[model samples]
Target chain A: MSSRPGVATRARPSAVPVAPARGRRRKRSYVRLVLLLPAFVSLAFVTIYPLGFTVYASLTDWNLFNFGAPVRFVGFRNWIELWRDQNFLIAFKNTAVFVLIATPLTYLVGLMVAVALDTATVGKRFFRVLFWLPLMLSSVLVTVVIGRMMFDPFVGPVDSVLDRLGVPQVLWLANPRTAMMTIIILQVWWGTAYTIMLLVAALESLPPELNEAARVDGAGEWRAFWEITFPLLLPVSSAVFLIQIVDAWKVFDIINVLTGGGPGTATQSISLLVFQQGVQGGNISYASAMAWMLTVTIAVVAGTVYWLSRRWTD
Target chain B: MRRSKGAWFFTYGVLTAWSLLLLFPMYWVVTTSFKTRPAISGGATFVPWVDFDPSLQAWRELFSESTDRWLPFFANSLIISVVTAALASVFGMMGGYALARWRRLGPFASAQFGFLLLGQRMFPAALLALPMLIMFQDLKLLDTRVGLILLYTAFSTPFAVWLLTEFIRSVPVEIEESAMLDGSSRLGVIFRITLPLVLPGLIGVFVLVLAGAWNEYFFALVLTFSESVTVPIFLANQINQTESVGWYFVSAIGILSSFPLIIAALVLQRFIQRGLVAGAVK
Candidate 1:
């Protein structure tokens, strides 16, 4: 019986031991490279190649209709001219203010809603549905829906209600002061759902026992939230903030549909400016140059956010 | 633990307020869509609530009021969304399967995929104008539904692959191994064993990809010409129409256009939430 067992084990070992020999190993490696090659090349030709082409085009005065006509290498002039361009300057300012307002506001609203949803005893599912619904909406559609009513000046319901209730009807998307303000409103409206998702995800992952411990310590509801729930929500809050900052930097459909950078170009964002220059005015190279600049800036900001997330989480 | 007094009120108050604001845009679009031409532009009282002197004035215009081929374009949008979702899920499933099973090549490929995905759509839509225009023109695909689908798939595939890859990776290899032991082929194991488990993820990614396809405008606008216009292009066409088809019909179109996406969002919101949490955590 012992001899039979040894023979059986040896037979199995001999069959299995040298199946994937050195030649098979090489072929397998080659196959893996083949499988992964498309993803890498797609990233290259589709993604990286365009980026490189845009950079080269920026250095030349490449007109829209004449990609073949751009032989003149007009060096830093596009960059310099865009720097002095008043529209670009205004767009940059508006973009900065937008990032400042929307990022924190989104995080705040998201955290508040997430906290509220977590603490709710009834209709939890419904609340989650309502809260997460907006994040799924297309920006173009949302902007189109709200543009007219929300921006209505005279006899607009907002004005009518405010007048009846003893408040001024501020021209929301029209007035330059409140143009940015209204943009912030649109942002917070859309961004809150994203924030809520992350915050809720984080809150759920957290140990409920910590919140319970705080409650047992006789911490008031607000104090328990401030001490326990709030701190843990920070990582998620930062993540949402980073995403909004990157996204808001590219704010387009809202600015396009709502204002058309109207009332003397008050609400022009970086992206809207690029669209106008590239498409409307046919200043292709300048727009591409400016766009490349904006892209690098955003990449840096996004990189910082990622580094911070890793710094804390790790 | 002692539950605090008035907490429910606070929660309810906050939730209700946010919901109203969230719902405000949808309400505004719906109400505005019902208004008459002059009522929309003649005065600032644009809310369609009282103006429910309800007319099919706008809807009629959207469907047949154009010699410029309206119905065909709407059909184009529908076809594109459906095709993009279907193809993206199928190919994305294959790609994701390969990725999930091959993670031993690199864990970083698996670990920080979210960050890579974050930058995936970073390229501005207009930036693709020159290159895609060149490529599609060469392939004789310019102004074709096939061209747009190709572009949509290109834009959305990275995210779909990343999401589905994670979903697939979470499926234990032992399941496949057991099926293989039972004399199943690789294709059979995938169809009979792997797909059923990740079905929710597949649907979730489909919804996400389809929603993105429906929303894309810049590329669709640039890549497509006369015969291939989507709803967004149809709406953008009205931009140059001076006198008649004022913002009222625009609002109507806006509401109508949003209907499919909103319903999709509402219906799949729950499944997507589950998919995200499960795929993300695992």
Candidate 2:
């Protein structure tokens, strides 16, 4: 735990400095920049350069495999064709639906679990670790498990359970109608742990006396939460919500492993489709175009959420 | 105050049920690892425990030349994660301490750190796969463990630095100054004084880095082809290969791959949580 300054002298103060210290700091900022140049360079390569390269790639016919042959520069043909592609359209639609359905559901469940655990008089610590267990397991493992148990046509556990209940033993994942839904369900399971951790942290940070006073005022549990707890929670929830929105944009591994965008591209996420084109199918330029478009769409969608949340919070 | 005992039972029952649901996949993994191929391949009955007795056959298959892909794959992951953890932590601490007290909480510095934090978390990680591979190859770091480590360090360090930096700032400055005034150099002050104080923060950063490296598939998929494959790649291949999908082998690797981190998390839950909340407003 951090060393705190208690009630007295409580505000986190900055380093006080003499004139010499101020001059030294101004000097040091530039010095730190020079010193930290390598880290900055590394970050640029990781974050920025790839962006530039991909953007350039999207505009041209640059296939490395055809190294012997000269590279051709196709204009915005790739982007135009990508927009026209039916599969790409399905992909965009699928990702939007998945995000729309998954986020609120995960938020509700994740918040309930986090808040309940945080306020619990017993097993709070134990439950925190228990809840986070899913997060520790790699998505690769989770996807494999999902691919077997949920997406499998026959002997999938979902169908097995449904069969016993006398419901139709429909293969929800294999069928186009239910494939996206199944993926969405799996996605929720994968992400709930993170939401639980963050929400629990925020809930725990709520001043205890607020709840105590709310109870004293004859406020029921639900009323107190709505009136006091929820309002207090909105900021952190805003942050978490923005983070999840960004996360939804980039999710690739689970979809790649689980469905492979099968059953006539019913469940192909934008990322999955992009990967399929660029890597597997070897349509590098077209894939780059798709990726560029998807990235822009994500930026617009998630960026709006981020901006709205920031505005709401401020 | 007497509520229904039945309702209390029901609440706990539901909680326990949910907890069991959370744990069953993991448990199923462990159990399936012990089942025979026949039992696993799903013939008459799917009960791993009931049909066939325990066997190390799957493990043998995993280690043998036929499935020897995993041997190198696991080793690659181990190297990458361990190296990433070590470098990211050391560099992170240095960077963190600098950020914490280097200059005043000037707007630009704070903005820089904030932007770093947001940018790292926000941008889709997998999108960098193609471009990063090209960059790494151009730099001759492609398909090299060192290349992957550098890339991993690039991504993981920002979060580590931010969190650790926040933790560093939270430390009473007088502690470092006191040590420094006593003929302790800046490095000495950091090593002898600052590090011990931020041990919990360091632990959290390491755990996070390890988790990132372990779970990272995109880079491991793209940057690494032959020699530098990780567990995720290995697992994916196992899934792809039609040579009898051994659930237990996958599960065993899954359990084995994640067990070290999970155990570390359990033991250091207090330390990690404490470190994680280091930057929360007082």
Best by DockQ: 2
Model 1: residues with Cα > 4 Å off, grouped in runs:
A1-38, A65-70, A75-77, A154-156, A166-171, A308-314, B34-52, B55-70, B104-118, B126-130, B133-142, B236-241, B244-248, B275-282
Q: What is the TM-score of chain A alone in each candidate?
A: 0.85, 0.84
Cα-based lDDT for every prediction: 0.72, 0.72
Candidate 1 per-residue C-alpha lDDT over A198-308 given as tens digits, one digit per residue, 9 for 90 to 100: 778888889989978877788888898887887777666666677777878888777776677766778888888877777666666888788877887788888898788
Clashes of each: 0, 0
Q: Candidate 2's residue-wise lDDT over A76-97, tens digit each?
A: 9898987778988988888887
Worst lDDT run of 10 residues, candidate 2 chain A, spans A1-10
Off by over 4 Å in 2: A1-31, A72-75, A149-156, A281-283, A310-314, B1-14, B43-56, B59-69, B104-107, B274-282
Q: Give the least accurate 10-residue stretch of model 1 chain B, judged by summed lDDT.
A: B109-118
Q: lDDT per residue, candidate 1, B35-123, as tens digits?
A: 67666655455344464455677777766775344567678888998898887787667667767776544455544543464365666
- Give candidate 1's TM-score: 0.87
DockQ of each two-chain model: 0.40, 0.42
